[model samples]
Target: MTTFRASGPPPAADPAVVVVTDLIVFAKHLRLLDAARLRGVTPLFVFGPETAGRDLARHRADPDHPLSRVPDGDVVHVPDTSLETLLRGVAPWLRERRVRAVLNVGEVFVEAAGALAQSLGLPGPGTHAAQVCRNKLLQRLAAPALAPRWTVLGADRAGDAERFGAYPAVLKPASRMSSSGVRAVAGPADVVPLLPEYGPGELVLLEERITGREYSVESLVRDGVVLWAGITAKDTNEADTAFFTETGHTSPAPHLTPAQEALLLDANSAFLGAVRFGTGMSHTEFRLTGGDRVVLMEAAARPPGDAITRLWRLATGMDQDAALLDLALGTDPVTAPPRRRARQVYLDHPRGLLTDVRADDVPVHWVGERGRWPDLPPAAADAPSRGHAVLVSRSRGDLLGDQADSRGRSVSVVLDGPLGADLDAVARDAARAVTISAVPLTPAGRTGEAVR
Candidate 1:
């Protein structure tokens, strides 16, 4: 079911931009509207059919939410998933409002946003580019020079895995997000059993797993030119696990030689052009191999998720959300060099019921202001971090390496210090100071058993 909130004051006769958001709306998206309003742009928002009610409720409940302040007439709900349907429903409304630009704030709306922009003759990556960015197989094929060798296989084609001649290959859905159903398989036996998890008509991809440090290149592209690029250091689940959950990230990736930086820029540029990404912000992830080789993993036409937009502002004084808004409105983005380094470490915990958390020794600000946390469900394969801490450090060295373990992280600490400070040691010390205690769940048959 879908709902629209156009109960507030009427919007300007003509708005400057339209932002189409998906089911998984992020807080930054709301902030984008607020920033545009601050800049005298009357922004209109179109929500997807599957847009979460909880998200909308949260926004409406929060007095500071941009939606609460924006004109009621600016909010619209489009209950359609098909690009043609969405375009047809929204095109007339946009034309009536005279919106100058369109912004796709989430993955679900990328293709639709592109189609709508093209229909309106606005600046955007065309539908073809947006479609390529959404599908992993297409992204790899578009940039063969930078992507790892990969092949598309049917659900019943496990025997064909031998063609890759690789043991530790990655198998993933071609078009899923949030690393769902993405697994690193060691052998054909492992690959065959996992294939059935995908739907009958869905295609799966088997690709060589590039072993190296992982990083993401974030850029603002204008007219096919990259205006500014930033490198983010990434930490994922432990190497031995099949789960590829992202655990942490640091901006301005601590130490990158000039050659490595150039390689990332060159590869990113090539990949974006190959996909025909023309404008707006781009988030492209790559793996840096032992020989300084850069291999593309994936690219998205929209801004990055997982608090990257907030980190960029803290670390580099760049408001990526606002910059993307400006790009959508045909304005040049204003960017600045890093004034401080920022790091976000996710909290993980083991499988259990109620949990106790201790963070008395960690010297950092927690993301959510809470004195005590509620009990969490038993940790599943897709267990998300409880919360994270934001740290601003003067020294890049202070933030390095993976601080959380596979057992599960539950707390993140942020800190800031001088240029030569040991952020790594600080993070380790913070991790040591914080501990998550959970009582393990009993076996399936022991439902009546008492707590030990």
Candidate 2:
């Protein structure tokens, strides 16, 4: 899922870092270029469908591709489609290439691919670390002290719910990614119904929703040392806890004091160490209770999910994607962000087919290009229109309290003002302002597209 430019690394090590991906996308391909420049090492892009091994014929034909150009015959289009086959094919290659370490490029395959590759040869966090890193329960158990007071991990729904005593209990799939399957039960009635979906897990975190400020920190770690840290202040939307969408985040987290920040960093380091902080990058999310007490929520061994990498660069001038590649290839990372604060907002509309389009007056960054757009999907359905907006302002204070939303299906506007100004009614009135249209509902009763 990562790619880099042709720049090589320190001492110009040709370690043949392998990028294991099922499909090659453009942004990821560009990131590989960035990685090459930072790590000072050129890596091989290996695409594995798992039925075979490196397709040499394809490389021969397009010899200009980075994969084809790398050390000719180094083009490993590993033909294995399954994890086992991919690992088997990758093991000897690492050994043969004298690969010093194996760090999964990003928070992908939830470390499954990384685990398989590690098992065959080379050094990595291994299977256990991957599992713990991906599963919240195991992560919390691996470092109990770092997490807040937590208990109860089971699937009996009613019984478990009764046992745990009430609503607001957190439930998430053991292998679910993103916010795809995480739910928070606020009361008794919400418990029994979630069983069909959450009932299958051997364990789940029934966390006491600690009232506090939430933050996610990105850390660049190398050989047990946390090379650099960037903090993110989170803004979340909860429609009764079942759907929590992070609407936005501001980095260089303005709220944490020096002492609180230290505690967070120390706790994060401790958690990483306990979880075997191997190498590469990790994004750790935690809740700062009362703005001081830090509780570890989860640590993903990848760059912070979403396009926060750009936000980090704007806020601090650090290229995290490059940092990830640097440490992956055994080089020090560029972790410090340049002076300033920056923010990014993701429009998480209430799920339904994007019935209409509006907001003709808002600024947005589409793909790598910039310009004002119109009639875009409520959420972009494909490439050329990744749903996002980037507002880069040197004056961080000037951006605080700013809010952007699509006003119904016909109007899109961003209200920029103070950081915590009155946006409650603004958000509430959004549903009314935007013409909410109902497309023909599917037989499954789920929302479908209204393709304009």
Candidate 3:
């Protein structure tokens, strides 16, 4: 008897990674694609049914979108975004290629990505961490020490809102993002009415309103080790509305004593450990009480949204997107310390039918050098103007609603300068630069009203 080994040439295609997310995230953070390209790895995108439909509509409406160039062959449309469905759908397709890692860039479907990575023996945020990141209730259960007193309420249990731990409580959708359907309830009576806002049978978290300054921590971890971490101070619309929608963010958290910073990091690390976070960036929001106690608001297994990653890149000179790809590819990421302060401020308009939007022509004084930034706001393409770059997320005819959540914000202005620069003043100046005109709608949300 003779033992024989049969072998052939290697696979013709380049090594690849599975990216489980939609196009919106890629459109905002195009550098993630650039990172993959720079590493010479193919990114096979897997879009869920809902995302596929939304992406198709957006592409048909505007073929010039940043992510419109993705080759169709590299795209995979799945029936749904569940872990089992993703594995069953993509596993066979992946068998033909050398898949390196699985990554999720969207707010939802993190557990699906984590489980996919685990099944492939690749690095990810781990199954437990991903699941906890997806659900507010799971987050509370996973890290009770850092979580505020919280109770669960669903459409069927609307009465439980009255038995909540305290008054002036915050009601958050158990598994939603961008602060959608989240509001501050004044009292027990106020809770039942708001229940209708959420989808029927949706779980809601009723937590004691932890009063304090809110901040977010973005950390890059690999193999359970934190490589880089930074704190960002944030301002929310809670003062102007019942919802806690983030209106602004300052990187490096301009004001943090050494002790306070240490406490925040400790709490974040504890939460990650409890959740068994494995790899990738974690965005953890915290509220520091008057007594300096750090309370966890929520955490996500993906990078921070709303271009906070860009702020981090500008403030630290560390391209986290590159680091993220490096982590996925089984390599250590290089990081840099904070160099300058950066802030992003969102602009909102009066509730009405938007008629016109304009910005004063001002020279965009490049703080250090010109063309150094990769993805400046959309307004940057028009002309050099101001110390900030403005990006409008709405059109002239689009209806403007109350600044209740992230979706309601109209425009965004981003600015960065020396640590001593008065960014708040710059932000004010930037806000004044833009003019918004709208027609006042009737009280019934009809257009048969006066033009304002």
Candidate 4:
């Protein structure tokens, strides 16, 4: 069952941008809201039940919550985020307000949001690009030249996983995010058992694992032209032994040679061209093989998640949020040269019940702000010359699962330093600065002392 609820008064005649997204995490996405307000555009947020239910209720109850900054008419909660439902639910807003664009912030609903934008003759990535971006199989099919060797198994024929005969391969869902259900399989034996874990009637892809360094290229496009692209070096939890869960990221990737960086940029440009991406931001992941061969793992028609945008801002002094808004408003995006290095590392913790997590002793200056966001730096000359901060995702009493995927991880630390500084050392020091405590559970349901 789906429900659409639009409360409060009707919106004003000012130009508005409809943002199709899920939960609102201020720590990561406050720049988006700040950007809209700074640009004099009203933001109309369309949320699904997953966000609208508990999270929305909590935000509405708390007067200090960031959602309180937004007008009540601008927040529309729908039971489902399907395209038909969004169009119907948003029709009234479009009729009442002067809507100029529709932007997508969540990976799962990119296609629906693009279609919504197109239906109203607004700027967007378009359905074709969004569709290709959403489905891994479609991405592989559309750009075979850029992808690694791969094969697909339809929901009806998923039992034939072993038929591919590919060893040391990667098994991933056709349409999922956050590295969920993405695993590195050694052989057919490892592949068969995982088949039952997938949802019934879900498409899966098995591909030859391209070995080497992993990185992501984030670009802002306007009228099919890429205004700028930033490369972010990525590291995964290889010790987990199965899933490719990202653990760290460094923007303006430190060690890439000129030639290697050029190859990655060209491949990213080729991918954007192949998909015929019209406008907005793109986050594309790639694996650089032995001979500098760039293989596309996947791409999303949205800003890179996990505070990578913050890294970019600290590294290059570019306001990616404002750049994204510029593209949505049918204008060219602004760019800046790299001036520093920024890194984000997710800390490791034991599997048990989380008791305490803190980095209070670390002299860290966290990026992003709630108030005076429009006046915050890069724009300000006195922006912190060096910065570091910690973010804890899980709360006390939360049961911590094995690090099989991104959701299993609990906390992360972000650091900023000079361009020539050792990012590796900076990352290591940041990790050691934090402290976590978890109480392990015994097989017979007994709880052990808190382990720090």
By the TM-score metric, which is better: model 1 or model 2?
1
**TM-score winner:** 4
**lDDT tens readout by residue for model 1, 1-452:** 01111232235554567788753444445557557867777777777776655656566556754467766567667777578767665655554565667888878888888887876678887787899989998888888888787888854477677666766788878998777778888877788888778888887888888898889989898878888988888889847578676777777777888899888888888998898888888899999998579998888988886656666766665667688888887778998766555566665444454234556544343222221111111222222222234322111112122332222233455443333455576666566666544444556643221111
Worst 10 residues of 1 by lDDT: 369-378
Candidate 4 per-residue C-alpha lDDT over 1-452 given as tens digits, one digit per residue, 9 for 90 to 100 = 11112343344467788888766333356577778888899889887755637657566566765677787788888878688888877888866777787888767678889987776677788889999999999999889999888888665444566577666888889898889999888877788778888877788888998889999999988777888998999999865578899999998897899999999999999999999998899999999999579999999998888878888888778887788777888877679977887887888787778776656555432222121111124423234434366766666787887778877887788777777777677677667767777777756565544323
Q: Estimate candidate 3's RMSD in Å.
A: 5.9
Clashes of each: 18, 39, 3, 0
In candidate 3, what are the lDDT values of residues 1-452, reduced to their tens digit? 11111132236757777888755565455576778888998788787764546545456345544356677667777877787888776765475666777878877678888887876678889888998999989989988889888888854556787677588898899888898888998888888887778777788888899899999999999878898899999999898689999999998898789999999999889988999999998999999998579999999999898868888877777777788889888789989877777888887677787665566663332211111223643221122223556656555667888877887877677777767667788788877887767777766665433211
Per-residue lDDT of candidate 2, residues 300-333 (tens digit): 8766754466556655555555666667656687
Error of 1 at 339 (Å): 2.5
Q: Judged by lDDT relative to the true structure, which candidate is superior, 2 or 4?
A: 4
TM-score of 4: 0.90
Clashes of 2: 39
- Rank the models by TM-score, top first: 4, 3, 1, 2
- For lDDT, candidate 2 versus 3, the one ahead is 3
As a whole number from 0 to 100, the lDDT of residue 137 in candidate 1 is 89
lDDT of each: 0.67, 0.54, 0.76, 0.77
Which portions of model 3 show Cα errors greater than 4 Å? Answer: 1-10, 49-69, 154-158, 362-374, 377-386, 443-452
